[model samples]
Target: MARLRDRLTSLSQPRYLAWRALPLGSFDPRFARLRIRTLVMEWHRTRETPDDKAWCEQTLEALGHEVTPGIWSGEVNGLLWARPRESEARR
Candidate 1:
């Protein structure tokens, strides 16, 4: 069971550095504005219940992204989100 958990956890790990027309180390400020959604549900290995989904959604909102019901290309293709800082929530 532990091995399974570890494997599942690793599934959410970042596989590649770039996709979605995003480049490697481009340093483009425009891409900086994009909000990336995180798969917080992946934190637990058992399951993704409604409460878990809500928690993920709320967490994303707290992060300031207008997250939808589906995973973003960033989360799907790559294991990264150029997430904005918490300071942005104050503005």
Candidate 2:
């Protein structure tokens, strides 16, 4: 995920694919529904409304993720990555 963080920062527009191929019995059940890319997109799509923002943030937190809108960042467990901000892109 360190590489993911670096790629997100360096690329003008970086995209990611969530890891979902783990064996059903190989890991914790909590991670069964954690599709990282989907989570980020859902956040980006619904960040406009206050209710939606709260819900998404809460959901991410419940999944043991840390989300930072200011940095366009999201961390899954310990893995971390970020998207470039609109302001930064214009600069």
Judged by lDDT, which candidate is best? 2
lDDT of each: 0.40, 0.42
Enumerate residue pairs that collide in model 1.
none
Clashes of 1: 0
lDDT of 1 at 3: 100
Model 2 ranges off by over 4 Å:
1-32, 35-39, 42-50, 70-91
Ten-residue stretch with the least lDDT total in model 2: 75-84
Candidate 1: tens digits of C-alpha lDDT, residues 1-91: 9999999888766542222233432323433344443322232112323243344445555546544553432332212232345565345
lDDT per residue (tens digit) for residues 32-73 in model 2? 344443234333222233354444455455555555564443
Q: Per model, how many backbone clashes are there?
A: 0, 0
